[model samples]
Target: MKKYVYPSEISGTIAAPSSKSVMQRAIAASLLAEGESRITNPSFCDDSLAAMRVAEGLGAAVEKKSDSVIIRGGINPVTDTLNCGESGLCIRMFTPIAALTGKRMVLTGEGSLTSRPVSGIEGALGQLGVSVKSNNTLLPIEVSSILKGGTAAIDGSMSSQFLTGLLMALPLAEKDSVIKVDNLKSREYIDITIDVLKKFGIRVDNHGYNEFKIPGRQKYTSTDIAVEGDWSGAAFLLCAGAIAGSVSVTGLNSESCQPDRAVITALRKCGAGVTVEKNVIHVKSGSLRGFEFDATECPDLFPPLAALAFYCKGETVIWGAGRLKHKESDRGAAIISEFKKIGGTVKIDKDCMIIRGSSLTGGLTDSHGDHRMAMACAIAAMGSSDAVEIDHAECINKSYNEFYDDMIKLGAEIK
Candidate 1:
């Protein structure tokens, strides 16, 4: 799918997309509960659907309705193979959940997920007495033995997802489990995990993001959950408003543990007019200026921040390039390479990305099969002098299926 985005001033009210991150965890937790669980305003994005399919493959009866999903939870598996689509979260988070079954199971996925590392899944699960194997460090991870909870030390420098998997899985183990994490990144995501766990009647003692204690034999209780609006997806819409015109995005939680919610602070610091009240965030074009932001915890913000920097006056320096190497694409390189086609000056200095504000002359770029890269290019187009043609723009369906439509609704001339 190719997208042609013309420079246009956009103004309107748009509802933010539901958070697939939260939805996936809710589906996982719901699958563990022993009764019917209802998820309201559920996300049907590709990743969230993958998680729902994972839950079904694990023996949960899943039914999708107009506004909610009904899931009946159980641990019995009807399928020996669980396909996670292209979601990194599903593969990592579900690997441990799948191990709870004593029967052997094979977990696989498509696209970039097949190339992403799974050694951490193997090591972490192995230490907990689950027999695991992976295709080198990639997918096709196989677990043959039931997960036996015990003390384990995890290397958290790469990603906090492995720890999240352990945190979610250890509660159902046969014995109490202790997880000691070193150099944890994205601690906020762990907070989101804990929040979801609590809603499902599980308790995890988080000790300063370094240690976690989870009692085994813990059971999950099914209940109704309302999925929050996604800050990560909303960042693009908000950036579009900051660069082009006034736009009000509704449904985002001001208190969301999502780290990408920091984009609001970045907008305010860069001189964009911001009005925050309840779940609606109104952003208007203003005198934008360069600012420094550390995205070490919210690495997904890098792409939108790069787009936002194009309208700023000076130079914008964003830290945390190291966090992008393992994403759908080498996201750090993808952002720098694709944004340059639109006349944005972006360069990487060690682990920091430096963007110098300049007039944008939009041209052609590719999504590189990354949803955020596609949305970022579209946001940059709002301030461009020429149309921005994005190849593989449909990649946005991974998280925000209606991203272009929402932009069009906001008066962006995108086709």
Candidate 2:
């Protein structure tokens, strides 16, 4: 779908969307738990839904409600083939879980997820006595045998997601497991995973992000969990407020382990009016100035940070461009190419993304089938001199399905 966003001032408050990262992890944990688990404030986004489907495919009885999901856990494997539906996390995280069934299972995904690398999955699972075969290190991976668990080594530089799977699945192994990680990135995401594991009565010992120790013969105890608001999606709204007008976003935890909470720090650094009162975060337009942010641990912040930087006075430099390569799209390249269409100056140098602050003379942009790219372009368009038309605007449904509606409610002129 294509949508045009015109320059307009926005005001009023909106509730942040539920965190799919948390919701998906909770779903995986619930699938491993023996009893019924109730998850409140869940996100029904595409990725989360993919995780739910995978949970159900692996023999969990899932019941969806208006605002919650009830899951009764088991790993009986109702089908040999599980479709992950364009969710990278689902394919990577659930591969290990599927091996717990001790049955031959095929894990496949659609769209961009099909092309994403499954580098560490095969090697790590091999060490744990699970046979894994992939499409030349990509998706549509086949797994057989059980996760007996022992010592495994994986490189964590590309992503910490597969490691999260190990941490979650190893506890149920017949023997204790130890994972040695090298060059680990996105450590905060592991924190979120461990936090979710704790809720399900699972335990893991982390040794300086380099290794994890898990005791075997542990059982997951199901419990009710409440999903927190996503800082990843809320960053775009806050950036919109910083560029156009005032916006107060509620439902975000003041202290979240999610790395995107650094958005607040970035806003303050860029001279935006930011006030935090418990769960409510208010950001207002101010004399915006360039800021420097190292997104090494929070690479998802790149898009919104890029948008926010466009309206600043000088130049903003965001580090960690190297991490954007294997995302939904080549995020760094997409951001630069799309923003160039809208009169924004952005360039990537080595591991840094440099954006020169300027007023947006909007034109047509494209989401490149990336959710964050779509939201960033829309937010950046709000302060443009002309309307910015974005192709593939519907892509935001992956993470924030109501993003356009929320912007419209906040007075954005979108058509």
Candidate 3:
């Protein structure tokens, strides 16, 4: 456990970390491309590393440098087992790609991922002519047979990643494929996948987030791509600035397609002093008023938005609680439970999360082994009357490993 206390006023500039979402998808695309793909500013977070490992297991040669990674693409299948290292994206995205080889491959991971649902993986892939067995929809899934591209009706309410895997895998099938998605949440993530695929020389036709048409027997052409800064991770920093003091975060793409970029809208609605200039976002402490937000598309914003709501006036209601059940934690409950320890009042009703702003009396809380929960508590603690202690603080490494160090650079106090 680590305890954190913050100075009343925090001020500085910090660069945002690379987006793991983009980096992981790029790694998968690189594995399917025929030649060497150069990825600049690659993320070294655990999740990104897991994707790299998965690529290598499937027979791609990965060379790592300080600032970039070189990947030579081919499905050589050097290993029969792929360890996803607790990253949900790695498991969901790579399982279908593995099935493309028509060989037995076991997909497993550590920690919460072992218990996370994979029925979507089994059901969706099974429909596409792949044999899959799982631990009652959990990890350690065994799959075989080459994927045959056809029509698959996928339930997208739970996650968009399953659709992403199908999109990435179907292009190589011998026949054309069509994906019909129902209630597709986080559609922007799928958009990111399509955008990355287009950059790698693959074509996918998306029809209003409902249906996707993919032509089979296509090849991924290698190219040099730069991974953008992560808005999901940077939202915590921007929230910290809103609640504690003024902070400027650089390197975030103002035109980023990342769903979590909606953080700025929430902050502005709550009366935070926010301004976007060039490639930087400046957030400063200001008088705040609670505002309503629908996080159906950008569910990752719930944590930081929840934390920011605690400092705003009146009650803030965030929609889309249904989207939180399968994340790193039951994030809706985790946010309500952890924030309660700090003297914040939060409640969930149906698909809505309600937060009543109040002064925080920082106290001990557990992260529920969730990265966003830990960072949310840490950021909320900054404006609290006392220090906050977070158990299993290291869980932040699953995504933003340098979270605390980045905060410290912007004048956060921790030990």
Poorest 10 consecutive residues by lDDT, candidate 1: 158-167
Give the TM-score (vs. native) of candidate 1. Answer: 0.99
Name the candidate, 2 or 3, with the larger lDDT value.
2
Write down the TM-score of every candidate. Answer: 0.99, 0.99, 0.98
**Total clashing residue pairs per candidate?**
0, 0, 0
Candidate 1 lDDT score at position 168: 85
lDDT string for model 2 (1-415, tens) is 9999999999999999999999999999999998899999999999999999999999999999998999999888889999998888888899999999899999999989988989789999999999999999987899999999999999999999999899999999999999999999989999999999998989999999999999999999999999999999999999999999999999999899999999999999999999999999999999999999999999999999999999999999999999999999999999999999989899999999999998789999999899999999999999999999999999999999999999999999999
User: Arrange candidates by lDDT, highest first: which order?
Assistant: 2, 1, 3
Q: In candidate 3, list every pair of residues with a backbone clash.
A: none
> How much is 338 displaced in model 2, in angstroms?
0.2
Estimate candidate 1's RMSD in Å: 0.8
For each candidate in the order shown, give its overall lDDT on alpha carbons. Answer: 0.93, 0.95, 0.93
lDDT of 1 by residue, 1-415 (tens): 9999999999999999999999999999999999999999899999999999999999999999979999999889999999999999999999999999987999999998999999877887888999998899888999988998999998888888878888888899999999999999999999999999999999999999889999999999999999999999999999999999999999999999999999999999899999999999999999999999999999999999999998999999999888999999999999888988888799999999999999999899999999999999999999899999999999999999999999999999998
Give the CA lDDT, 0 to 100, for residue 217 in model 2: 91
Q: Which stretches of candidate 2 lie over 4 Å from their true place?
A: none
Question: Which residue window of length 10 is worst by lDDT in model 2?
Answer: 84-93
Model 1 lDDT on a 0 to 1 scale: 0.93
Clashes in candidate 2: how many?
Answer: 0
